[model samples]
Target: MSELTQLSPQPLWQIFAKICSIPHPSYHEEALAAHILHWAQEKGLHAERDAVGNVLLRKPATPGYEKRQPVVLQAHLDMVPQKNSDTIHDFATDPIQPYVDADWVKARGTTLGADNGIGMASALAVLADDSVQHGPLEVLLTMTEETGMAGAFGLQPGWLQAEILINTDSEEEGEIYMGCAGGVDFKTILPLEREAVPAGYQPLKLTIKGLKGGHSGADIHLGLANANKLLARFLSLHGQKLDIRLLDLNGGTLRNAIPREAFATLALPQENAESLHALAQEYLAVIKAELAAVEKKLAIQIEPATSDAQALTKGCGDRFIALLNAMPNGVIRMSDDVKGVVETSLNVGVVSTEADRAHIRCLIRSLIDSGKEDVVGTLSALGRLAGAETIAKGSYPGWKPDANSPVMHIVRETYQKLFNKTPNIQVIHAGLECGLFKKPYPQMDMVSIGPTITGPHSPDEQVHIKSVGQYWILLTALLKAIPEKN
Candidate 1:
């Protein structure tokens, strides 16, 4: 029993501790799902799995609250798997190691998984605690929401009995999210032309690392650096002065996160190596000064590298660098409706070059469908010009803000009454399953609320302890205030 279990709202914290012991990365949630099933069974709750692999467990309304309208607590089962380049932990098999740091709990050198794990834990705690007052409650845990809304997409119409949906996926406690942005993933593969390296060419590795990468959508406007974009720019800058051949290039991991590190293996003349090394140092200083505030510890290095593969042909290398440099990244537009909110943005999340092929992955987010399409068109056109294959997938609609939501009104009033402070209600820039639920349960009023979580989709992720207790209080209070069905 760590101190985390001793926190206020112990039920939620204890269950969250258990959740951290299991690996539930996107597309690899079998073990976690099984744990959930077994937990529900032990409590004699009616739990079943939908065809889409979502877990739904029902707890009958508390004795006196039976007549209130049923409510569904929704959260995703999967968490994004991200770690520092040197961390040895595996997302598929190894459990997340969480530690208390002052007011927040963070995982060591890796993403904390608190993004949805804490939300899921809150739902499970409600089912386990018998003394809680609540109307009929259904907990719906979806699958692969981090990689894509797989479970939400396969959700069958009329499957849920709830007339009201309370999504627990939103971060930042006290703020209620009534809507969110839509997103599209673009995967591109540019075929490479290879040729023999020039005589007496030595191999050197160019590295750009230690950038403070964050969520592609939520943190896109923070001016944090992207490793892929930086690597491409650095190489392109010096590529003109010297004819460098790329032996191998790779950077980033998931399309939803800003890349923190990137490196490339190059074949260059021994005499030209010193020039490249000097340039790398120069670029490092420039980058350090550029991102001093947001990205501390930025590092660039050039060291001896080992690679026997042939280097990319000069023309192919030029085209590859050009494509990446030209790709639209960062905030494209700001919301005219919501002050200081980003309306459209793109992240060049991952880029790599194999023996004969170069691949790049990008994520675009927009509050409106048209804005998303515009970026898609620009990427597709860039692909055509580069003679690369571009595939777009996993697109979900954006949730439009609804100011008249009954649940939102109740939540706002309840928060002010409880804490004597008004809560901020805004549409999030990140994608949420709320948009998908509106399809099946069109009439179901929804609102999202959760504890304060920072650095989601990245290794710096953490949850605030005090905010979690406050969130738990607000959630239970909302369930007790459910209105009776007419």
Candidate 2:
């Protein structure tokens, strides 16, 4: 048996192990979907797929609970594909090699996929376990949630019959999330003008790596370093004192992840090369001191390069660097309603330059619609000032908390009775599909809960071993405690 199969909560861990063996990265879930369909068929459960690739599995009520109302167990089917720059694993072909790390389960140099994978496993285990008592159950597995809410947005009005939704996507084990922040993607594109490399100039590459880039929503409040922003500051600050031309610059991979690495190629007068090297070292020392506590390994490396490529015109380079330095990133506002919770934030997640264009992508999130709009407007103004065109897309609404929700009471009561402690009833800054699901089913009551998952969307991702068992118990108890429909 695999190491995961030996874990406590055998059914859930085993299912998760199987899931890891298949490739289910966002927008590439066909193989995993087929596997799930085959598993449902083998288990003789009624399963169907929606037009947007969402999978729904139905299990009849237990013998004595037939009169109780049906419940929907929801989780996204896709996982964010993130790996260390030096890791050789492929999300498509290689299975996540998860191993026990003391009290947690982590993968080898890549994301563990526990953000929603464990939730998916729990639902599947419930369907397979005849020993567990519960009412009628519907497992709604959505697709491509990491990239965008494509599956949630495409959900039809009648896609689900259950009014009570239990979303198994939240990261904390002892927290029940009733509301989440809404988000929009802001992008800016600037036309680039490249000029022939001036005579007596030499090319050099500057790279910034080792920043602890993480989930833009969950970790933005931690004050981590953004490599893109740092690089821009260095370039802009030094450009004013040196004769240099930017050849190319790029950083980050996903729009929802804080950039951890950045690279820039520049051409400068041969006489200034040694001075540039000294300045880079000086800047590195300054930045290291600024982020020493949070980003210990943060580094700035400069090396010689042999290239004859043209560089961006001085005007364009200066403008681009200035705009980046001025971009708003990290936490914008803290929640006044919920103590210690982030109400609004933005992440400058990606920046890249092509032959004739430079692009900057950011993800903005806020608890209130007005707050979201304000941030978008701010980004637009910045883009306009830099002679770039700005566009916002993939906007989704936030889920509003229902303080007097009947289902919340039941879940709270059940959790306390089982553990002799209260779970934290809270709202998260991260985006959840429960927000989008509310559009078609406005009356649906939703709560998001899951085992403890740390460092999601990064190679350091891990899931607590003991929390999964507690989560399973709580889930089962809540299912059995659901009241009958009037």
Candidate 3:
């Protein structure tokens, strides 16, 4: 019930409010696309949707600026679906219920979708504002961005005539993203064989939660808590001492988001109960001290599990522990050319245990293809050593930075003039649609920027209330500052 008037004077927030009123989860964005199409038509701008439901709206240059080259404003229309355990909002049909906090705009209990929704809103605001001087503009909004880059990848070549693209998807406001790491997800399977629970063993459930998790790519280098890694560390170090039998294990929800919490159920000999509790406390202190500055609420709790007799073989438990320990979960290398860019990284994102099989999802990212393959090879070898099957899927190539880009000059000058300071130019360890788009336009010039956003893939995702105003001013200035083509 909160009104949009409480936000800043920028009209992008108004468009964002209207976008929140629609239900547009990944792969189900028809209604939102239709709404955008209607808005474009009302403005007398040419608009069209691709076969996969990606929408592109075109606006001609203002009368005197017709000689300038056209620019494409890009953003994804789909959003990652995540909600709190107690929230009852359905991503498929429920509208995002957002409210204004001191300086942030966030939803009640679900993901705010500001990742790219704010991008789409900014593009719309530009398209609707006629008084602003600019050259020809194309607003490209793609679908299914969270699950796969389907809309972006499936976009036909030559669909847009613009050679310069501005992506409004990066999280930081003052930074300009010139390149990004490519990535792929690998699904590893381990055949399961259940065994009868050994006598004198009691089932216990261990839950690791309350970690402040962030984007797997952006925050992976921060040495934050990954629940899967913590849980595996516990089992690896104490499996022999506790005489444990694995029953079920699971952690993480999304491949792109860092695993915040994980849980596992197992049966352990009652004789070692006190020893196991002490070990848990020891590990908790070690991890807490390590992540005290970042994840203040990191927790590890143990309780009796309500399950009948079910367990895994001792050999399997040991092997699982070894595999988890071997898996990589942080920044692998730093860029030599770009000062602070993460060149390579990996995330052991998801793990699930079932009666007949255990599955693990690992996401690997690297600016260099060789580094990416090297990480994959290391993980695959570990899986082989543990006798588990592994297969990689949805591999994407990186968008290497074009240092001699023409747009970079204008972007740098515009940023310096607006902020009174130089913006940091760097490549990110996260996946962006720019890589896929470049496949279609090899010579395309591109740069990414956005208002300040935090907790992008989580329910805590929020956008800064003041940065939107600054972002809009910079974007409009860039469009007008570009020299007109003859």
Candidate 4:
């Protein structure tokens, strides 16, 4: 209830809390952007915005550090729009209610947006720190990064002049991320038909809920259950036997977040109602036991539908389930070079059945362009086989790691001096804007690092409060270690 700035010195939490108080969900960031610009002006720094609403703040080098090369600190300004079905928070315009739970800061019943808000907070924190020695600095806060990398894509040529970019977008705290996967979002549409309700039948709805869903890219290889897949499996096993006619189906919402819950409606023989209820309970136990560790809270529900006379069209129900069962989800391949890293993956993230056609959104990710294309090809082929029209959008390239990067070396050395251990350097399976930023600044050297964050892309997302202090320590040290140009 009290204002965010009332909490001081802990600038990371303060700035993050301030950010939370504003509604900056993808494409609706006017008030949040104005907040950012107002803050930048208060610091007496020059802030500029491009036509697409991306903000850039420039700070001249400290007196003795002017000779060093300028560095750009980058983070997306917008967060992914996601919330628990029961939560009343609105993305278009509502404050995020966050609480500290021992080690991490989390929001109530919704995503905390730590994915890049922490990055933005860290940048603003650094800009505000008077003691941290550094050369010239430029902070570029982009808009609408989660829905797509449109904020990065919308940048006109020469918007950022720095050749070195520090992206604070990765989730893990200690590891230094040098490269990341490229990805694309594709959707398929299928025709729908209607039929009269069957006689001597009762309408019923089945649901799968309470899974601990996460970022599809970061959590794909874990073999977590997909709600749509579980629903289809249930239908495949008991549908025909129960004389069930599935009418409506839906699951997931975002292309990047794992589907947490799904439900379907169907008409079934009234005589089998008790048997169906028993089956739902049995299946809940079986699935909970199967995914006990990964998805401890998984649940299943079976309830009578509001209307017993309504039934799904025979044509639409058959094709919809068939399409879901055939669609690919989860890790497609393991990295050949990075040992444990996922090389390629696909997620059938969102599906909606409409009156005329079904719309399905699939996300494909890979560390290489060729591998990404192969996954896309496989998805397209499957969609074609299912008689669905497919559309691919939101494509972004991979950012290849540079082992010999000067800024990377500086960060590594500074980290060792501060923490007394070499930082783990690796390529991530998720997408980062550095991939597209490189297309413009071909010579740009980039690395992504961030405080520890967990359950990103889901309502449980949080940031480690203590890690922010250490992250700031390492960041300032790296800035001081940068080499001065002749």
Name the best candidate (by lDDT): 2
Q: Please estimate how well model 3 matches the true structure, expressed as its whole-model Cα lDDT.
A: 0.86
Per-residue CA lDDT of model 3 for 1-486, tens digit only, reads 246655665578889988898988897788999998998898889999888888989988989998898899999998887776668988889999988888888999888998888888989998888877888889899888777688887888989889789999888888888889898888889877778998888888888988767788878888877889889999988988789888989999887778888998988889888888899999999988888888888888899787864687888878887788778888989888777878889888889988878898988889999888999898889889989999988888888888777887788899999889998776878888999998888877899988899988778889897888888888999999978875
After TM-score superposition, the amount by which residue 201's alpha carbon in candidate 4 deviates from its true location, in angstroms, is: 2.3
lDDT assessment of candidate 1: 0.90
Ranking by lDDT: 2, 1, 3, 4
Question: Once superposed on the true structure, which residue ranges of model 2 sit more than 4 Å away at CA?
Answer: none
Error of 3 at 418 (Å): 2.8
Q: What is the lDDT of residue 291 in candidate 4?
A: 89
Error of 1 at 115 (Å): 0.7
Total clashing pairs in model 4: 0
lDDT of 4 by residue, 267-338 (tens): 888998888888888888888889887998788988767753335676567667877887778988898988
Pairs with backbone N, CA or C atoms under 3 Å apart (clashes), candidate 1: none
Cα lDDT over the full model 4: 0.84
lDDT of 2 by residue, 229-337 (tens): 9999999989767788999999998888888899999989988888888998899999999888899888888898876668999999999999999999999999999
Give all candidates' CA lDDT scores.
0.90, 0.91, 0.86, 0.84
What are the clash counts of all predictions, listed in order?
A: 0, 0, 0, 0
Write one digit per residue (lDDT tens) for candidate 1, span 1-486: 386788878999898888888888998998999999998998899989999899999999999888899999999999999999899998999988999989999998999988898899999999888877999999999999988799998898878999999999988887999989999999999999998888898888988898878888778999999999999999899986777888888999999999999998888888898898788888888988998889988999788888878888889988999999899899999999887888999999998878789989998999999999999999999999999999999889998889899889989998998999999998888888998888887898999999999899999999999999999999988888889988
lDDT of 2 at 393: 95
Candidate 3: worst 10 consecutive residues by lDDT? 1-10
